[model samples]
Target chain A: MKNPLYLLQRALTYLVLIVASLLSVFPFFWLLVGATNTSADIIKGKADIGGALIDNILTFFERVDVPLVFWNSIYIAVTATFLTLLVSSLAGYAFEIFRSQVRERIFGGMLLMLSIPFAALMIPLFTMMGRLGLINNHLAIILPGIASIFIIFYFRQATKAFPRELRDAARIDGLKEWQIFFYIYLPVMRSTYAAATIIVFMLNWNNYLWPLIVLQTNDKKTLTLVVSSLLSGYYPDFGVIMVATIFATLPILIIFFVLQRRFVEGMLGSIK
Target chain B: MLCGGERFDLARTGLARTERLNGWMFIMPALVLLGVFMIYPILWSLWMSFQVGRGMNLSFGGFANILRLTQDPVFQRALSNTFIFLIVQVPIMLVLALIFATMLNDSKLWGRSLFRTAIFLPCVTSLVAYSVLFRSLFLADGFVNDFLLGLHLISEPIPWLADPFWAKIVIIMAITWRWTGYNMIFYLAAMQNIDRSIYESAKIDGVPTWARFWYLTVPMLKPVILFTSVISTIGTLQLFDEVNNIPPNAGGPSDATLTLSLYIYNLSFRFMPSFGYAATVSYVIVILVGILSYFQFMVVRDKRR
Candidate 1:
């Protein structure tokens, strides 16, 4: 607690930061440099780029149906993202805007549901999906998550900032509820939607456990599941696996970079 | 001012009624969908919990599953493993997150935003990607072992994913690597919200940096700390993806990483469809969460003035 010890602690703090930062960001760098190295060099801990970048790309394409896998990931992410935003935001808006005693109790119950572990319900959920005859279908992954409690809570929190005067003005202009929601509310909340899109896309794209259980074959599998299966093999290839991880992780990184500014802006707004 | 008093009151009442109706209309679809998907399945599971199962052959055996849960070895292993994960991982992550957030919060630090974003990079990484990547990086002949060998830190490779003890260590490291930054973001957000006046006063008093953090920052941010711990507790309790994906659900050479969630999965699917038994096992998780979180909530409440 003395000044000399304080200075030492400050120095220690900075040291921890640099080391932690390197440890956090080092793997991505490894993946990038590893991608350029040959399968043998990569496994041997080569940290620099080698001449195998083109071959790695070609090999990735050759072994896995790269385009199909990419498309499957993209389609699932986009569709799930869109539907989740629509359903969750709609309910979120209604929850905050329409204050009633009964609705308040319902919202409270839903919040409690948010705290339940998913493992508690996953089997029963799978049973329901099975009964609906939706096994091996992407809809099984897409549907159950559409009413995500977290996103709904987020939107409700954000909607508190929306002005009541705007709603009154729209009503005075003879705009119906649906018309106001579509033309005014929807257009005004673009940043919120962007943030939600990135988060939801990441969830859908990287979704593993559920999709792994539901999806039956290689052809139907997403990139995440493929990487999992690759690791599960008897003689796993670290070099090939690193390449797979890089490919699997790139889209989400790209998405985060493109929309990160918006996410922060939205975070400030929602939290306020 | 323009309307008669009785007419205005009547119109206001009508508008209030219509708003209530509109509210119900808007939420109806989500409510119905949730009921069918979440609420209905929960009730079904609750029912199934009562019916004893052997290979999916269900027969009503009242309270039988609950009695069986008290004696199951696998369930006991899972409960203990889950507790170990929560107790260890949450504190390590929270401390790492707090330190990182504080460091990143300093404006004098160069590349603060980049470090913040990069630190957060793991959270958005695909789970399977990292799981596979960690398994390989810590493999017997892989990068971590080779690096340690070159530096003369270890006489031999550490068998990270093979041996029971080391496998748990590798899993913990993998989890910590992936989630530390995510939690750090939460702390960073909360720290930024804190007023600068408090820290400035502490500095002016010649209070040590560690004392300033311990006495000033922590008590102020107790709510956020409590929040992170609760979420982490729930996450670690349902610790499946990392174990299942990384070690490919075999857990290890001797199943050291077998978590409650993974056990529930095995019981239901990998084993011979002991749906009733699996339900019983899952309820054990619910009970564990319920008990631990109750104590945590009490601690948080006692902290709050």
Candidate 2:
């Protein structure tokens, strides 16, 4: 009787997990399928693959400035990722390495700032960017995100795992503060950086609200903004939308795949 | 052999002072950027909230926007919709995540890494892509309706986007599908950190599986549970992308899924720009987040006591 019950429990566990996995993964599969079908087929709930991949890709590129829009997304996401990693990791390293009363208070204040919704700040932020003549420039998108409080918090938590002795030894060797950081600390924390890179890149790549408000011109839009605008039209082509989505999703997916291990580890570091 | 002048100066200033200055120096870039972008904008929004007027033209209203909030039916609908999402979707996602995490934590579980990757994949999916995919999936003649109809679950296709109540349900489903795995990853990480000996002892003592999960696991996971809940609360209160992208025209079908963030967007950008009233609506989010988070923290605090 007990053995039968145990078998039943095991069966149930597998059943639940299989269902959850299918639910999570089926969308991407369907998304790929959708990209190959025409709009009418998609509307008809076609489940099978079609041979319109080339046609969809051609239409998507023709409808939108694929190269320019993709370049805009890449430029913004890459620059923002690099700058965010530098600024936030430095602050995190500093808060941990040079602990002080004032710094602690400031850190707490920064956490409170994190809770304030970005929606509240968008209008004023837009107005401020407009004043600076950065309304259509990519810099407006990159600037506000360079000092992400969330990334700073993540780096701070990850830095807790950094060995103190390395810093002490580097100082004893007469390395300047900056030299110690550049030569020793940075080299040691490669996995943390890898994890941060994946996360920050995905965030900047998929960022919608701020970019939607800031970027006005059709020529200046990122892939995400373009995809959104495409949907807003009177007669959206599902095939084209799917193709754009696939392209929008590819970079982040690639990053996630390449750095899967470190990404998970980075999350673990933050939780600890 | 350190440089003599630099060494002498460093000694005179003292290491603490050097550390203090270095700390400030390291954080200076972030602080400057945040001050200009985050802090300045936040303060500007606060001031704007108190004023009254249309775009670019404004004057001090002294609580006029606040009073306007009371009479704004659209704002009222958005607030209720956001709360409904917060109250319903968050718990469902968290509990599902907890269950999945616990199951995945078992070393004997088959295909653990595959399951973990599959589950976590949704969170990394692009917002626009996910929204577009969901809108298609839940369309009147979409795969979801087709499947349900084939299964004899319903007689007719549900008007997912056209109906107000169903739109909210579709929004909830979309959010849950996207976020449950994200939360599960957090819980899984925390679960991995739990000492294995406790579980081993429970098994040896013949404690049932459900009892072990409830008694042993839940208590240990309280902190992360609190953390995920607080985050999900903030995320839900400021819900925008799902509703905005899923529904037509950013918030359509009679504003059934109009989140607070979407409303703020509509006011500032979509409609005749009312920056002040929009700013005022934006504060409604801040106040709600503040109150809800405080209550959450208080509840956690009391539990410890």
Candidate 3:
């Protein structure tokens, strides 16, 4: 156990791990510490905590309605996450459980559609949104992204890993297809739903380019668009931006921490 | 399972067929929305790629637009830059991810899950926030310069955001930092499927650790690696955000960070409305992704052979 070779190996692993872990956590530390400093101090590369946290936060509140923006972001994120799970999981389960050639072709078509750059379609999509008079409505942002191809693919894979016995038993019990999907499949796949909830929420919450292009008014803006405008000003307040980022990222981070066990397994299922 | 009499019976089965129709009805909403939004725009952009016009009123210029792409210096520059980012960043990120996955896979390694989560944190951070952090850190008087100066490695601070070469490097580094963790999440998930006993036996047979990794894990993780590579290639080619954010302006320092996607953005938004050319540029990205994805599929197929 005291072998010098073992000691050397442990030392090397620890060094690599420590350096990597530090690099990963350093920006987060910077974010936290920056919030405690002023704009000038942050720009000057001040590393220690300053007494500007209250001032920075107060200035942030004065500049932006923190409560409204936070609510806007959470509402959009939650609704989008919920609908995406409901829509995509149903499609995915149907695709896997009820196999058909035509649906397979439809899935293939969706896959190809996934590769089309969202930027290319933004103008047309915006035009359509405006035509439908949904411009500035949160539905304008939520509707277009309801059927995420990535999430659909994810649920399809997870469905494959599902036990067939459950479905067969449900059939024997005379549960309607919808009922079985709702009652049996959904409950057993809580872990998958958890994973999807985190990912879909993260994506919808952080979505920037589309929302920036579509949502014109300040009230319609999500946390990401708000943050983007916040930084795009003549002089970005890094301290306050850091605070906003911390707030914006907290929900996803909390979800990730809570559901990581299922998340990793879901990722494996999806990828393979 | 279904043939002859039973096949006919199932086909004529009203109740069962109604259930099957319900399946299509279930997916109909997604399909309809995607068709109007995705398919129609894609076809429209493909058409716009052909027409050479600046504004809404336009006449078809046929292949003249393609000819312009051949001669336009900025377009040519963007094409090359996109290719460069695609070629360079994908490999580095994938390799780093694979290495991290391997190290983290070793159950003997201390703090495996913690390391994985920490490494994966950057991807979860918002694009704007990460960009702000990078811009500040790479500024002339930023932490990176201070660190280098303190280490006595560089006599003067490196012009990270100024020079063209360094600008590209910074974009690549920014991308690598943000995405390597994301790709590692995939690799880590894939690697967990691998049987540990294989590695254990390899160790027992005195296979060198490096050899074991090179021979065992790489082969086992090939499919997922290909998956990450294809996605990374597409992501890098559509490399708008990093360049747009890291540079002073959108693509700054004499257009060093000017990418195809950014150039397309400039055409539609920053510059005068050249919707046709922007649509043309968007088609180029579609083509690039199509070609790259096809080749990756081929490679994966061949590897399976």
Q: Under CAPRI classification, how is model 3 graded?
A: medium
Which sequence of candidate numbers ranks them by lDDT, best first?
2, 3, 1
Judged by lDDT against the true structure, how good is candidate 1?
A: 0.80
**Candidate 3 local lDDT, B1-305, one digit each (tens):** 34569767767578668668877866776677677768888888888878777757768888888888888999888888888888888898888888777778777787888898888878677776688778777877777888889999999989888888898888888888888888887887778788889988997898877898899989888888888888788888777766777666767778888999888878876777787778888888888888877877687678779
* Superposed model 3: Cα runs more than 4 Å off: A1-9, A266-272, B2-12, B300-305
Q: What TM-score does each of the candidates earn?
A: 0.93, 0.95, 0.94
Residue B126's C-alpha lDDT in candidate 2? 76
Model 1 residue runs over 4 Å out of place are A1-10, A37-44, A264-272, B1-6, B292-305
DockQ per candidate, 2 decimals: 0.60, 0.75, 0.57
Tens digits of per-residue lDDT for model 1, B141-184: 77888889999999988877788888888888889999888778
Residue A153 shift from truth in candidate 3, angstroms: 1.7
- Per-residue lDDT of candidate 1, residues A1-272 (tens digit): 44687578667767787788789888888888877887677656677778887787777778889788778888888898898889888889999988888999999898667766777788888888888999888889888888877888888987888888898899999998878778888888877888777777778898887887788777788989877776775566556667888889988788778888765554433322
Local lDDT at B24 for model 2: 95
TM-score of chain B of 1: 0.92
TM-score of 3: 0.94
